[model samples]
Target: MDRITALRARRAGIIEQMEAIVASVGENEDLTAEQQSQFDALRAEDDRVAAQLSQAEDLERRRAAAARPAAPLPGVTAPVAGQPAVPAQPAEKGLTFARMCRTIAAAGGIPHVAAQIAEANGDGGLFANQNMGSGPAGGFLVPEDVSTEVIELLRPASVVTAMGPRMVPMPNGNLTTNRRATGANFSYTGEQTDIDATGYTYGQVKLSAKKLAGIVPISNDLLRASSTAVDRMVRDDVLADAAQIQDRFFLRGSGTDFAPKGLRWQALGTPFATTHIMTMTATPDLQKVTNDLGRMELALGNANLPYTGAHWTMSPRTAMYLTNLRDGNGNLAFPEMQDGQLRRKPVHVTTEIPDNLGGGTESEIMLVLPQHVLVGEHMGIEIAMSTEAAYKDSSGTMQAAFSRDETLLRMIMQHDIGLRHLAAVSVLTGVTWGAA
Candidate 1:
């Protein structure tokens, strides 16, 4: 039999023996000393065989994918004489951020474990220059493919990205661009007569990296049972927490010293609030709600902004309200709502839009020109781990990782959001359509 088959067979036998040992004990009766030792040895053997089987399966998948011929390049009428065309690099199936985190934790948070893991997975040349030095703040730089996957996965998880804004790379951790402040005056003038001069002014739109960090405490059991499933669980949990926090700052940040100025703050800056802020004076009906959204569009349209890339942002509660609202003919007022569009523009529903603005019974709706919204990110996600550090739990109680036998995986991302034009954002406030 092949090595893989033999390992699986061995693991099955170990499981059967372990089960028999457990069955030997009566209900509510403990195992004898001899039986306990035998079970422990068999359990260890099972874990070893499982690891071997997992590695073999991963290698088989890689081999199969590699064996497939590369698809022919489109629009290639002739071949180049110098050399063969380079194939597109794929995200490696071997090294992942979660797998890297597992290595670091298993090695007691040593950063160089990343390099060791990479070398063992036939990627020695790829990570040959990884930093091997150790320091407190020093952490493993995640593989490029893994970091790219994390960014792509963040799109569906983050409303800011799901809305399809302009993504800007901030390698230097900061960016600045011109924002038009006023337009030049134009009027009829007499031929050869002295003409009044008018100059269009400009302001600055700046984006600076802000540190966002989250700690995910993983069960120690995963360390012994590492696999692709463990990787997915770690990646998903981190994505959910990271996106939720990012949406909060991207939508409602008060432009404080600690947080980036969000869409609402940008609208409340001045001219937008005066012209674009639509207030709900009464409980919304089909007509009132439709009119409110219409006025919001007009607010931007009147400013000469096109609805080509305009998008809608509201809370889940508000979306359902519109979905349930019916017209005079007893048909859906917004029939296309189920397809995630309002007025034919894409709609992004997120709980980040507060429903308790005034008197704990209000919400806000934002119509934005996505192209005018910029999300600048520095280097992607970086990971660090700690086995001896103490951190506060979700309930505000302090817990030690070493004592709990859990690993604290700390993920840090640096990114910031800004608007090239503040007028590109319009908000409707004090909405109580679906208030409880």
Candidate 2:
């Protein structure tokens, strides 16, 4: 049996033993010392077992809750909570040229032509057609299922998305929700007297969608050969571009020129206060690391926040430095690093966190409560294909139309990030690798 069951059985056995001892004593007679001692010890064991059982049950319940997905927000359906909603699955079929044509037709919003194009292109007619170009006759919309699969593949690769923030769906361009600015105060009052009003401090967290787009070119020959290959290629290319950009901006982007307000900047603002910012006294060593974490715990405790679900985020370089530190006896200072957790909390490493030292060149370690971070995403990705359009290069220079011979598949994604509670985040700055 599981731990909970075992504990219950042990508690029940203790109770049975206590009852038998009690029954042996007469109603008017007190128990002998030996008998009383035995009964007392059994009762104590019973209490201890009961406490353990309670704790085990609580943990079990939390595990169950975490495994279940969050409920859908009222009146919203397309974008579910926590993760983007994927479109319904299409019927299963073997990978073939006809299948590719059908997907393209559905995505192009002409589902009626799926069967006809599939039949004609079963042996590769669509990609070989001479009329194929950027016009309506050439381009097809990617089917809903295909687009959904790409998104599913992208979710795991995104650091911000994998962190499990409070996902809010953006039905429109923006969303706003009230947050607790201050908690209610309690005071003792005389009977039959009116009580003073305990005002509640409140603030708002507003999220506005920011658009991110990327373009990928596909070879005409590859598009006709295997649908599976094309699907994987498109998914990987789009995800590679989007994940890096999203991770960088979501962690440190300044709220300017349509960019989302990032976590780093938001944590430095109001309600978080200077106390939330912990600085190491010296270079990163076991003593300093312990001290810094203690301060962070104290800050969170003073703010009346629980450490549950809190985690640390830093650069992989910083993690490597910490994990490599040796004690005076040459033993590893942080053996727990091997398990990817510190102080029983998870550690997330991302390159987005810089590793420069002192004078604003310092690397940062963050203690984050995921529930306080809000992420909003538009329902689905918008895709468009073009062959003749001249696209601007990454350097902001325009490329000549003649230089582009492949079809450019443009993907647009909209999302936003906000902090529901600033106190739920803490940062440690000026952290360096070793002794200066």
Per-residue lDDT for 228-293 in model 1, tens only?
A: 788777777778888888888998877776678888888675766899888875967888998999
Pick by TM-score: which candidate is best? Answer: 1
Per-residue alpha-carbon lDDT of candidate 2 for residues 185-217, written as tens digits (9 for 90 to 100)? 889999998998898898999888998777665
lDDT (CA) per prediction: 0.80, 0.69
Each candidate structure's count of clashing pairs: 0, 4
Sequence-dependent TM-score of model 1: 0.74
Regions of model 2 farther than 4 Å from truth: 1-149, 192-194, 217-224, 357-361, 387-407, 434-436
Assess the local accuracy of residue 357 in candidate 1 as a C-alpha lDDT between 0 and 100: 83
